[model samples]
Target: MKIAELLRSAALVTAVAMIPATTATFAQVDGRAGPEFAKLFATYQRIKASYVEPVEDEKLIRGAIDGMLAALDPHSAYLDGSDLQRLETMIDGNYSGLGLSVVMEDGAVKVISPFRGSPADEVGIKAGDYITHLDGELIYGGDLDEAVQRMRGIAGTSIRLTIFRPGRDEPFDVSVTRGVIELEPVTFEVQAGNIGVITVNEFSRDVGQDVFRAWQGIQREAAGRVNGLVLDLRSNPGGSLDEAVELSDLFLSDGAIVSQRGRARGESLLYEAESVYRGEIADDIPMIVLIDAGSASASEIVAGALQDHRRAVVMGERSFGKGSVQSLLPLGRDAALKLTTARYYTPSGKSVQEGGIKPDIAVPQLSDPDWEKRRKYQLRESDLRNKLINEAGLKDEELVEDNLADPRFKLTADELKEQGVEDFQLHYALETLRRTTPSAVALRR
Candidate 1:
């Protein structure tokens, strides 16, 4: 199948264009893998004739498709029915649900991250927590799609979740009332020292435009005295590739942003600045992009681009290291294949597959009480089974870096709270900008 323009991370989904099937397709496949096809057909026949229980054709075929995709990588999968509906919901950027990005791990529903300011986040639903039961119903070893369906309902509905958090003594129950999760992809505020904090929750549609507008709002709110900018991308699971490029272009005036290369025809492409948004929206403003273990795919794209271009100082823990690009290839009217089509690289030819975009300055989130414990259980692209290997042959030490032991960051969560610092990373970035001159913030070579 020809690759689509759509690209996303593991947590997000994409809508695809349906490609008309050609009769030559089957002939070409048959000619190439005739023996493999014969063996598959024979296995199907044997199962149909000799299996103890009579299985539906739909179940067998679906299982086969699932099995094929499962062997490739964690990001690729078959999409149909509710899966397709979920894609629509994500693209619309609004849904009535728990506002969680989840994944199936060893038949368990794992929370990738909760949308900021959502009911889940408001209720303290954290990443690395596994949902074992929904509304007192055991959902372990259940379909992820089914579990997701159970979590979603009309607004004002409540669902009780039994959470099995790592490092905790026992599974705990949390009752959360679902709400209309109108995902605000970009939320901006002017912080102290005339620093504009633009938080990108996800790389959903129009995020580039949303961020541009947010910056404008920040300038207006700051009375045209904006000193610095913070592109907070913490826990952003990633969405459209176009938006990632557009967002990167906002701070970059020229040069290649990113490029993707794959084995298939038409799979290789290059994106550059000034292609999407024309010129840098905040060209002179010193900017810092914040990331963590939750950042992946399109988040890496934006971070990688800005870091490569030296437009922004990337600060935070090492990223999730997902550099593979996934494209939604339509299988039929209701189904599609979310396949890993290409491996993308930064402008300097750095692949962030297993070794994600390394921060210019590693800043830990000291404000989180469970930061140490949660980091141990935090999942990234490298942690996922059947992940694409980094071609660069990343060393063990390179993948895992010890947090810098700065005496300044020695405050406990309670101590930070007492000082009115809720987010240590953002506080650090704002302070860093405030301390440095504009030229020092830009770090132009």
Candidate 2:
């Protein structure tokens, strides 16, 4: 069967953490059905007739569908009932739960990152921690959907999570109160020296418009021209491909923003500057985009575009490389398939599949007490099972940067806290802006 026909969905739910949708009719089976199909049919017949117990057709069919997508990549999956509802909730940009982005790795539920200012983040839940149990019950080797359902509840309800931090010798439990997760896609403030700081928490609907308004707000608040701009995308899991393109268009007046290539025809497309927005809003303002290991998908798209055009200097550690594009194909009225269809590339023709977008300046977060320990065990797209390899043929070791001592970044977590610096990465970016002029900062490569 043709892949496109097998996967079809009514609505396309697209995000960095989840990319979804394509509408296509199933093609007729032709000579392409080789001996493998006959073998598969025989196996299915034998299982249906000779299993130890009676098996429902639904279970067997669903298993077969899952098995097909599982071999493709980690992002692709079958969505039904609660899964579909979850996707809708994400698109709507609100839900009641402990705000978190998680994934299943070897049957273990792993935390990707906690949303900033959420209950999970407030309780000191860091990324790369394994959630082995929920509410004192061992949940290891359980279904991911069940674990997620257990985590969700009405606002004000509490859920106890048993966490296994990799660097720690023992597992620990923490109680978190669930709350309504109302994501503010864009937030901004005018900092000292008229530096405009805009934090994009997630890329939801109208994100580009929100960012533009933020710039206007900063300019108005400053009562004059803003000295510089800091676009903080740390810990931002990507959402909405169109939003990414729109945001990139806001900064660049010309040139290709990003490109997508797929195996099938009509899947290749290029997005360029001035296509979404007319012109640059902050043309003369010195700009810095801060990204870390948690920055991914749509975040990478924005950062990569700005970097390629020399429109902004990207700072912080490397991003979570996730360059593939997933199409949400609807299987029927109540089910869908989230399938990886294409891989994206920056304007410079760089695929951030395994090798993510490297920053112009590598700035680590020194304000967190466990930053060092967490850094050693940090996860990224390349770390996932069955991840698409970069066509450039980069090795796993080569993708990882060696930890080196830096004289400029010598402050410890305690020292920074003592100095009242809550976020070392943001502080460093602001400091960099205060000291250097836009002309003084040169683009690498």
Candidate 3:
């Protein structure tokens, strides 16, 4: 099926595509006896007959399936029942809970990044914090799904979270009241000097259209012509791949946007500009895209495409580096497999697997007080166990760090705060645009 159709069928599955029945073909299994298969059958038989206590066949089968998927990579998983329902709710773009993207790290639920303006972010729960307890009960080493379920509740309901933040002396407790998370995927504001600032929270359905509408709104709100644009993609965990392509198409009039390659013939394909949207919306305006370690999958797609075409100057830290694509293949009516099916490449044939897109201007969030401490512990796709390696053989050491001091950003966090700069990265981008001419900004490329 087309990527757009796959996304429409299951819109909630983030950074993944759904494999249609025709493309779900698999390699033929050898009929000859294999030692591995024999061993597996023997173990199953032994467990059924000789175990100390009786175990249900369903439990054993599910355990076997989970074990197989877990050994492959981090993002692959089996979804059924509540898991399937949750995925649907998330994609539908409305749910009642603390909006946070979390992952299982060392059997502990670690916060990847809290959605901006969500209950978790409002409570000051930053990324890399380990959630140790829910309602004063120990949750360490427990099932991550269970902990996540406990955190979800009706709107106005409260839950006490015990957090173990790195660089802290001890764990702390905070109570957050749940609210209906209506993800406004695209929000825009006309910044100072008629600069448009558009923030893409997550790549859900109709994001491309939303962004186009945002540009129109900015034009209406601006005093005159929009000078420049800032596309803020910080702390955004990716969603629909089709939406990513559509967003990228909005800025590019020609050239390949991205390509996906997999072992299956049907999975290898190319996405090009102008395929979804026509000519650029803000073609003449100098654009800047803000990204950080939390940016993944679809975010990387847009950043890489814009940077490759010199359509936008990508700023902020490197992205989360999730280049691999997951294909959701249904096992039955109620269950499915989220399997890693392909690795995506940018227009220049660069795979952002373990090494994500590097920004043209590497800017840091100096307004954050714990910037230094947090930078040292920031998580990326390279940190995940069994992650796919970049085809270019990029090493972890090659991951660029913005350690050099810039004269424009010399002020410390406290100094910036004193100067009324709450977000140094965004402030820097705005100042860069306001101070420099469009030709000067283009010269940086």
Candidate 4:
């Protein structure tokens, strides 16, 4: 539920706590090996000797571990041995799993999105599907770390998942075989009208290079210049800051694309225009970037920078507002402290925190305020905002099915299906590209 702590908390799901985080029992303090460290050690010893109720050394150890990790920022956390190994595989960019990214939401594990070409996608695991139960046990009370671990295994093994998809009540079971998930960072399609569509799933280490090459390929297919470009970034939980900067540079000729500010060190790094692209498309390009709540971190940087530079028009709802940076600090032996180090700024000097970057144009979800009354009437996420249906009777919170439209994606369903991309967000983006010309206005994708 508290996503900020997800990075580190994933490892300690099964570690029973001696003292609950509440109850005034202990202070969440981090003392640097001086008197404070001595105090913690001293108190820990006292707890073993006396404490009203009986306590165990293991309990004291857990508290000390929690405090130590807590001081190092929220992201850096202790992972159980097996959980740690699983994540390492994900980071290495190859995993034999169901191929879906999930989140613990509303007492249920929901499928946030499926990786391109993963077995989950092949088996039809869609975004917004709620996993009420995995196998036969209720997953609501289970640890998310365990849920993740259970869903992954060696290639060729079958795992049964019971999913509750949005717009459907009865949970359905799907038998999926795991495979090596190689996330293809780029997917392209030449639209019927000569429009070229490109969807960047996430800004991994090689994404920028893949994107640049794809751009060239599109240009070559269109011969000299492409009619328009659709850059779809919906559900792109960000990675690699370097890729964000590199992708921004591809569009910018010369300007301060982004800046990072932190304690003690302000403006330690300034990214600006080193050189203009000598390529033919350098002078002018019209693009539109489609984003949603799932687009975060580095994705927000690219969207914010491009929008500020007048390079692209940003569309969709606000971003995930994760502008803070993390730096890993050593914590003795295979352990490290991943701490929030800095807050990044857009080229225009805006912070993507608290309130995520808002779109230039605002389009409320179709369900008017008081949508709970209308949810029964709603079908698809698009149905919540069904303009044709009079949902003026819906509640404000209930009607905001804004994910139906991510600014980064502008293609229509027809176009997406034709391109073999069922992602609606990316479809919208490709369509947006068709409507604009480079000379008209700088755009985003």
Which structure among the candidates has the greatest lDDT?
3
lDDT of 3 by residue, 276-347 (tens): 877878888888999999888999999999999888899999989999989888765677788999999999
Q: Provide the clash count, candidate 2.
A: 8
TM-score of each model, paired residue for residue:
0.93, 0.92, 0.94, 0.71
Runs off by more than 4 Å, candidate 2? 1-25, 28-32, 442-445
Q: Model 1 reaches what TM-score against the true structure?
A: 0.93
RMSD of each: 3.0, 3.7, 2.7, 9.8
Candidate 2 on 1-445: residue-level lDDT in tens? 2233223212232333223334434453466677878888898899989999988888888898888888888888888877776666555648889988787899899888888878999999987889998989998889888998989899999999999997787999999999999867799999999999999987877888999999999999999778889999888888778889989999888999999988767678898989988878878888899999988888999999999888888999999999988776656567767788889999999999879999989988999887788787888889888888888889878886857899988999999999999999999989888886655663222
lDDT of each: 0.83, 0.83, 0.85, 0.62
What's the distance in Å from true for residue 135, model 1?
A: 2.4
lDDT-better candidate, 2 vs 4: 2
Tens-digit lDDT string for candidate 1 (1-445) = 1122222322353211122345764456546677887888899999999999998999989999999999999888988777766766676658899999898899999998999999999999988899999888899999998899889999998999999988777999999999999988899999887889999988877888999999999999999999888999999888877788888888888999989888766778898989987778777788899999988888999999999878889999899888888766656455667888788999999999988888999888999998877777778888888989998888767777866588777899999999999999999999999887845945453
Task: Look at candidate 2 and tell me the lDDT of residue 129.
Answer: 86
Clashing pairs in 1: none
Task: Tell me the lDDT of model 2 at 391.
Answer: 81
Range of the 10 consecutive residues with the lowest summed lDDT in candidate 4? 11-20
Location of the lowest summed lDDT over 10 successive residues in candidate 2: 8-17
TM-score of 3: 0.94
Which parts of model 4 have CA positions greater than 4 angstroms off? 1-43, 46-63, 67-87, 103-112, 123-130, 164-172, 266-268, 275-283, 362-424, 442-445
